[model samples]
Target: MTIATLFAAVVRAKPITGFIVEDDPDRPQLARSIGLLHLTMMGVGATIGTGIFVALTTAVPEAGPAVTLSFVIAGITAALTALCYAELASAVPVAGSSYSYAYATLGELPAFLIGACLLLEYGVSCSAIAVGWGQYLNELLAITTGWHIPDALARPPGNGGVVNLPAILLIGMCLILLLRGAKESATANTVLVFAKLAVLALFVGIAIAHFSAANFHPFAPKGMVGIGTAASSIFFSYIGIDAVSTAGEEVENPRRNLPLAIILSLLIVTAAYILVSIAAIGAQPWTAFAGQEAGLAVILHNLTGAAWPAVLLALGAMASIFSVTLVVLYGQTRILYAMSRDGLLPKLFQRVDGRRGVPRQNSYIVAAGVALLAAVFPLDVLVNLTSMGTLIAFAAVSIGVILLRRSRPDLPRGYRVPLFPILPIVSAGFCAYLIVGLPADTYALFAVWIAAACVIYFGYSIHRSALA
Candidate 1:
């Protein structure tokens, strides 16, 4: 191909309002049935998983009692990006999350690249949370029945054991629910989110009753450096806020519900995170947080010598992680469906079940991919990479907001980011700053994933693109 032809093929942008072409009878379109409540539940279900439940062990050790400060910093960064995402979702309501926004604003090449980054964010998040579910399930079973799942069944290869059966089983369960339909899945998620919140509230209530002000001494023992690093890590907990946007096509009244869900999800999750961090730190010395496989349960165990609180925490965690896996898996399948519809991926992803009005095959494919990772990879290996991917995707959405504002000022936006370009600029900058704090290996893995995506784009997608 000539240089001009190559540039034209790669840089051509999709129209912001043209993502869903539902006129064709044979074409499978996602069903729009989710209301505002369901959308918020999705955001909640996807956002509050392993990050708060399992990550405290690592985050507390890094920042001591001031990990609460880290939670605030991370929450602020997420709020900025969530606002940018809200504007984009209102302006260009589509199924693919930031990838679709990039396609409509930044062109096809960037869309393909952003789509790959989202795979890391959502896909790895599903795996990591499912692995966490395995640990919590073991704890619950051990407490209730005196029999824990063997390490060979509970752990992944890198974690010094065989396949993680419970993790894979959890993914399979979610796959079945998603294939059933969006409403069923949404209802299940809503129930799980409330249950998860109740358990968290119980923990905070109990922890506060035992709050020892002395445990907070030397609050910044590790200094600003540690707080910043811990903020970067805690950022993972905020990953699912964008899942609200990913369901644009499936939501009722997309323009209105999308932005409301995004904002509320951010506020709710952030407040819970800050409160939980404070209660946990105040209840016990920060030093006690490290090396606990299930941090919250361990905290409860310490506080009440009775095993019941720990058992309750474990049961709550199992339900919480299950919801996370379901929502993250749902997000990934919807994104892939959008990409496939645009001819950037195989047609298989976009195929919906006629009776159910949901993408059964796509859900299965995503579940298998997530299950493989959950069965093989260790938790730490999956967590940092997910944070790196999320930071890049957040930056892309922030930049897309700015670009869309400049290019399509006349376009009707249901929600506009206040202060013009300021929010988008700050959001992008903050996300980039967090990206830099990640381990170098995470960056290298991201580079490899994006490079592989580019190669696929050139080799197959370019020739078959719908725009072509």
Candidate 2:
């Protein structure tokens, strides 16, 4: 192959219209019973957990009481990419999410790399959240009962012990719920979403009563750099807002509902995060947050002089994080299923159970892969991978929005990005800034992964893809 031929092969793009397809009966046929409510809940359930539930300990110290502002800065950054997702999801409405958009608007190689990013964003994040779930479960256990899971079983390899039993068990349970079908899984997630919200409301209701204006003094004690860095760290919490786009096939009124759900969920999540951050910071001295893993619960415990509050918060974290793991894992499977259907992956991944209307094989494969990751790897390594993959995938989607607008303006969009070319340009640029801000080690690993994905695309995906 000459350089020109290889370049042509790599840049070949897919048709920029229609739902998921090659106009073949053998391809997947997903049921569309999910309404706007469930789709929005899917986004909320995926977004509102680990970052708020666990990461505050690290974030608050960086900015003092102004970590609340960090949440806003982080949210604005997420909102930019989210607008891109909203516009693309409205226009495209495919289960492949950003990857499908890239294939249609960018090129096969970019699409393949976006697919890789989605795996890290969804699968690795799922593993990391599940690890969080295990920790909180142990917290809940120790608070409610006299005992907790042994470290030998609870900790992941190299972190402390042989394996993470509780994390895998959490994934196993979610797998069972998912195999029941999409509607059922969404229903379960909806319930969990509400449960966690009520728990958060309880925390806020109690904590806000003790709000001291004095605590917010010297806000941004470490200044704007600290706030920005904290925002970068907590931006992962804003993820899963795009998880709504991954369920395009399973959603009713795809164009309207997908975009509506994505934006609405982000709005809801940002509001909740800001409210919680304000309440937590106002109720306690900023210096007191440095090492409190259960910060919010500790706030409650301090206010009421009780252990029950911490136990309840622990229960909430466990349930809420379980929902995060479930939704993200679900997103991962649907993405691979789309890749397989497009011939970028093995056919086995696209195999759907006709009776269940779910890609059982894809779900099982993703769950098994992530469960193993959760059981063996510690959370520290996984967190940066999630952020890097997430930002790159988001950046690609922002770029895709501009390209698609220029290439196919004739297509009716359910939601047009408010500011047109400028919004998409800035969205992509912000994503680039965040990606560049990631640690050097993270950048090196991300480059390696992209390189490897390019090899797979050149050696296999290029030839295998019908769309390419």
Candidate 3:
């Protein structure tokens, strides 16, 4: 109970030998089925969903016409952490992403804490992404049928509706695809990612065609504070970039492909986000971005003064949300599977289908939990929560990079973080800065979640951990 004892207890880490060396005969194995292209699509699938599709409506109002700069700021933060992610993911090549990396570097207790953060990140993010699907689906329906879903069924109760049925249904579809197996899920994600990207390209093309210089006047109306706040807010859109690491066990030539996918996906999404932000701001006044549902589709509808283009964008948004949710849900299940294999949770989480090679029970549990959140919470509530969890996990990854470099310098790595300690330290600093900028309520909720996780860890995980 003394300080020295407590410090030592928390720092008791696992050996940095193998990510797949579990002695548990019953532990499920993941097939090495994902390649560079599919893994990059997984990253794109996990990101580029609701952020550009829906988060813009919220972020643009904060930074005014300067929102594109907000994308740059957030992208830099994400890229820093991603570089750290790439290094750890390459060397570790495990299912838990940051959690596994933390275990390898920061010890069992810290790893459990990071694992808790990821549980919150992936679970809430999957739901948050799905919640916007209803809005876009309604948009598509309204344009084609002259009618849309009633608010009670389309929006969450927090948004002045009873439940979000479309979001639940979207989660249901993802559940089916995930249970089929990893390769099938990744294949579908690749197709969906391309479809959504093309749709975004169409959006940017239209926005530029109608670009007005008037909208760019008085850029940064709210100045530095506003831009920083908006960057912190929109960073939620970039949450799933680490998802590439979650597929470590399933990636082919993981040391090479894992880092490659992580970096490639970040570059691709960062460019897409920045381009779309500029185009949207150019096409319309930043003041007009607030409180719009299916905002991209709405922008097209207003710009072109037609319904067909909006409907087309709405269809794309649906595809984006579905792909994002599917991949995030997949990430969540893999995380639980990893934790369970390490004896952090119940064995049920690690149980897999003998034929399909996925943690079947884990998928069903994660889908049901995400569906409930999507059905009940408003998009705004879940968005900040997801960001909060991801920020902490990101900071952990950066710190993990530093810790592992000192502890295991001889370890073979497929990728080395450019500039070494400087980048990782800066990455952690950026994540901390954004964490400080989040709303007070977000901090309070995150504290409560962490407290709950500590309780579970002390009461259950610490006693059952494989390293114990």
Q: Which 10-residue span in candidate 2 carries the lowest summed lDDT?
A: 16-25
- Compute the lDDT for candidate 2: 0.85
The candidate, 2 or 3, that scores higher on lDDT is 3
Query: lDDT by residue for model 2 over 1-468, one digit each (tens)?
Result: 789977887787888544544445765577888999989999999999988887887788888888898888778878888888988888878788989999888888888899999988898889888887877877777767869888889989877878999999999999999999999999999999999999999999888999999999998799987787677777777777768899988899998999889989999999999999999888999999886755676678789888888888888888899889889988999999889887989899888888889999888889999999999987767777888888888888988988988898998789888888888888877777666656688778788988988888878888888754
Which residue pairs collide in model 1, if any?
A: none
Of the candidates shown, which would achieve the greatest lDDT relative to the real structure? 3
Q: Give the residue spans of candidate 2 off by over 4 A.
A: 18-23, 26-28
Winner of 2 and 3 under TM-score: 3
Give the lDDT of residue 155 in candidate 1: 96
Residue-level lDDT for 31 in candidate 3 = 88
lDDT of 1 by residue, 203-291 (tens): 99999999999999999999998898888877888987878888988898898999999999989999989999899999989998887
- Give all candidates' CA lDDT scores: 0.89, 0.85, 0.90
Error of 1 at 309 (Å): 1.8
lDDT (Cα, 0-100) at 157 in candidate 1: 95
| Cα deviation of 361, candidate 3, in Å | 0.7
Relative to the true structure, candidate 1 reaches a TM of 0.98
- Arranged by lDDT, best first: 3, 1, 2
